[model samples]
Each structure stands twice: as C-alpha cells, then as structure tokens.
Target: MSYKDGYKWRQKSKQGFKTKREAKEYGHVIVKELDKTALLTKDTELKDLTFKEFADMFLEIKKGHVTHNTLTMYRHAVDAYSSINNIKLSNIKPLHIQNVVNKMVSSPTTINSYYKVVSRIFYIAINPYKIISDNPCTGVRLPRVERKNMIHTISDEDLNKFAKYMREKYPQAYYFLQIARYTGMRLSEVYGLTWNDIDLKNRKISVNKQLQYVKGVITFEKTKTANSVRILPIPPILEKILIEYQTHELEFEYDLVLNPYKKNGVKCQINTYLKQFGENLSAHNLRHTYATKLLANGLDVKTVSALLGDTPAMVMKTYLHYSDEMKAAASNAVANIFS
Candidate 1:
C-alpha cells in the first residue's frame, strides 16, 4: 500500500492473505489505518460506521426523492444485506459482498435488484461519506440471467378465439382488450383512460397518465417515462367498437371507461383463458401481439416506438430477431418484383 506523507510518496508492505481479493481488501484496510485521522470527520469516526447505519442514512435521504415503488426496492436491498449489517463500512470486503450475493436464492432478476441497491450504498459510502475508499460490491459475482427466446405473443388463431370469448362473455373486458390490442397501451394506462381522453369524432386517443397501486390504493400517477405520454391514432375497427360500447357506458365516480372494481377480475379471467390455450399469457401479451405484428407488416422501428411510447432502441432490442425475419421477407419480395 502507498500513500503521500506531506508531499513524498511512502510505501507500506504487508503479507499473508489467502487470495488476491483478500490481499486487495487488506491493502485498503492498511491505507485507511495509515490515514485514519485525516479521513475522520469532526462529528463522526471513519471506522465506526456500520453497514446498517449507513444504509439507514441512505434510505432516509432517498425517501423524499424516489417514488413509493423505488423506495420499497431500496428497503428490500437494505434487508438483503442484513448478514453484513454489523460489519464496519471500512472492513467490508469483496468476499463478504460475494457471500451475501451467493446466499440469495431468488431469481437472477430479483438478485440483480438487491445487488444494485447494495452497490449504491457502497458508492455513497465512498463518496460524500468518505468512510471507505473502495466499493466492495464491485467484484461480487451475481448469478447469470438466461434470456428468453423471444417476447411472448398470441397467434392469430388464438387471438381470434380470445377476442370472440371476450366479446361473448365479458363485453366490458372485450372493449378494454380491444383498446389494449389496437393501441398497445399498458394495463395501467388503459385503466387510467377516461371518455375525455378518447375523441371518436377525430379518431384519436391521448395517453396522459397511468393508474398505480400506491399504499394499497389505486391512484393516478405520471406515465412510466415522459415519452410514455403520447397520442395514438384510433383504427376503424376500434372506433366502431368504441362507438357501440359508448351506448352502454354506465355512470362511475372515477369517470373511467373500465370498471375499476371488476378490472382485476377481468384481467384474471383473461389470463385464465390464455393459460387454457397452453401458455401463461396476460393482458401485456396483447401489447406484444400488436408490436410483433406491426414490425412483421413492415412498420419501421421509430414509428412503432412512437406509437408504443417507447424508444426506438428499446423496440429494436426487444424485436431484433423478429426484425431479421421481416428483413428476409423483404429480401424475397424485392427479388420476386424483378423476376
């Protein structure tokens, strides 16, 4: 370990750590010890801060800035590091963080969430807190995440069956499903819609906000991103259905198009129908079906992204394989045109 002693670089040597990671951690310890007095604040000691203590401070600072959902995630992250709660900030090593990561038996996606939270805490400890110089979470190995073959979508025959079932059995759910299918709106966004958002005369639908479950209550919240707030052109089929459904609209306190009380049940029933078709699909599958069809039918990524209220980069990434198939079709068409 090396440090500057009043302008001249000085070196301190140590030995006997089992592995290179352990040796690297020991080196950080040495540097902290050598400059302990300088690192300490007037009101706080550099070596006295525990992981739990720092995490508490981090959460307290985060509470006001982040959403309720994000704060909940941060809390889960703090709980995930309970094993190392008592360990001093300066004493935590890559091995300690790695052990905690390995102990988590959850899915890779969930584990990554916890890892990100722990990493942020260590990052804060290194910066403004100055309690530690190195972030131990950097070298921790997380479980590998397996990517899916493709995003799931409903086949045309299955889609026709689904539409027929919804229309016959649950007229309200049928209308909701049609809007989701045609516009590719999220479940929350579809639930958030009101008659005011729909312009049957103009054939337009404005997506302004979304409904979220906050503190056990369904409340209005901003869209997932700024770009998520957009306007979509309503197709003729959807417009025809909306016109008929409008005649049967009932009075509701929230002025929502779909019944909030029965929407959950409707979604559950839709999911049940999909499961019977031999796959676990949900309302979001309607969205996937829409995007995949549009891409297959020659819509550009940028235009589809704008319609879906997502970035073109995100659209391409999600459907790159499908896009390649579309490219092959286009190539065959171009060759046959001259032939």
Candidate 2:
C-alpha cells in the first residue's frame, strides 16, 4: 500500500482486516515508521540524489566567496569532469571517479587540484545538504608532485650586456629594466607604477597596486597582500633615470612614467616593446636578477626576504644554491688553519 505523503507502506501480518478503513489506517502508521527509519539509516538517504545536481548546487554556493581567478579554475575542472562522464548522482561509484581521474593527462598538481574541488563538493553534500551518506573521495590517492624550479637569474655580466642592448635598441624599456632590478617589484607592479608613487625627496617608490590585462581590458587591482604592498629605496642611478624619465614624460604629457606610449591613457604593452631587444631575457627576469644580486652581496636572508616581499624560508629555499657557493668560498678561505 501507498500513502499520500509520498511513502510506500505494507502490512506485516496476513491476518484478515475488519474493514478497508482499518487497513488504510495501518498503512499510514507503517509509512510514518519507515520515514523515521530512513532518516536514521545512511544507505536510504544517499540513494536520493544525482551527482550532477549536487555539484551544481555546491558551485553556485561557492561562487560568491571565491575570487574570479579561483572561480575560473573551479569552472574549468567541473566542466571537464562533466563533459567526459555524464554520471548521475545516485549511480556514481568510486571506480567511476577513479576512471575519470585516470583519463586526465595533465600534470600531478593539476590533477590534484581537480580532485580537491570534487572532494569539497562531496563534503558539502554529505554534511550540509544531507544528500549523500559519505564523501566518495575519502581515501583516493593522488600522484606525487616534485617541485620544479624554473626561474633563471640574470648574471651581472649578462645584465650589463642586456642593459647595453636595451639602451641601443629601446631606450625607454632600458629604464623600465633598471627600475625592476633596483626595486625587486613584480612585472605587474612595475607596469602599474605612477609618478605620484615615487618620492624623489625620500628616494623610494611605494608599491600599492598591480596593473593587469583582464579580458582584453586594463584593470588595476590591489597588491597580492598587505606584505606585498611596500616601499623600496631607489638606487642613485635609478633615481637619476627616474628624474630624467619624469621630465621626458612631462614634456610628452604621458600619465605613466614607465611606458609613455598608451592606448586611451592606459599603459602600453611592455612585453611587446621588450621583444624588440632580443629573446635572451624578459621583463620578469629583472626581478630574479635583483634577488640573486642581493644573495651574492652577502645580504642576510631576512633583509632580502623583506625587500622581495617573501618569507625568510622562501628566500632561503629559492636562493640556497647561491648561498652554497658562498659557503664553499668561506670554507676555502679558512682551510689553511685545518691544513
């Protein structure tokens, strides 16, 4: 028998009933008991929903709290998963998830990110929505990822060569490189710099924001963090360069000090100008050059860390190879005493 409350019910005993009304009442009591039991049991609750519906709900709720860059990554992962296997929520199994993961040919880090997003969705469904009994991704193992260092530090000799090349080929870009080397600022931060941010009297530049091209439009946003917003002292040579550059900018009536050429008052594409010099280096290489030079000059890790807006540990980890050479030189200098 069935009840109007959308539950199936049945009589336990085969004893004959006195009337149809008595049978209907017995069916209602059985259905109420079953409904209570369903709430208590895990298996019954998990069988109610589809995986696709749960994922959609989770993403919709998460969209408001996350940044646009984070949302883009989440959307990419979810869309990729949905496109490959159109599995329903109730029918999804551990093996199905494993299969979908195996088919992905991306790097270990990327695959792990995909798994993380999916795992979070399942976690929300289980606790908050009460749609699933448990998270399916509980014990799934991810691939090990070895961190690869890809930064190339510009050497002093090479830096001089690059400067000369820039001077000869692109005079304006040469000054941009000079500021980047002295300030240890990121590419976006350098591009976003304005004349007002520079304190000629104090010989410092206040880094507060970054300029980026988003969706083919120029947008200015806050620096990555409170620590990232800093004031860096300008080297004397760079200060002279800036003074001359500022005068030039005023003569041309350009808003930005770095790249005077602009489209609708926005900074021009620096990378496009950089390419004319050569393929040996880029604008970002200037930052690496700054950090490496600091390490080479026997500067303490903490000081370099602060200047570069990184933690001391990160500075040690990334520049330790250079430090090792310094250690060897010091050891050699004291070898006569041991000998």
- Best TM-score goes to which candidate? 1
lDDT of each: 0.84, 0.69
Question: Which residues of candidate 1, in runs, are more than 4 Å off?
Answer: 1-49, 57-70, 124-132, 214-216, 330-339
Encode model 1's per-residue lDDT on 133-165: one tens digit a residue. 678989788898887668888887887788898
Superposed on all Cα atoms, the candidates' RMSDs to the truth, in angstroms, are 5.4, 9.8
Candidate 2 lDDT, 289-310, residue by residue in tens:
7888887888878888888888
Clashing residue pair totals per candidate (backbone < 3 A): 0, 2
Candidate of highest lDDT: 1
TM-score of each: 0.79, 0.64
**Over 4 Å off in model 2, which ranges?**
1-71, 83-97, 112-139, 250-255, 260-282, 323-339
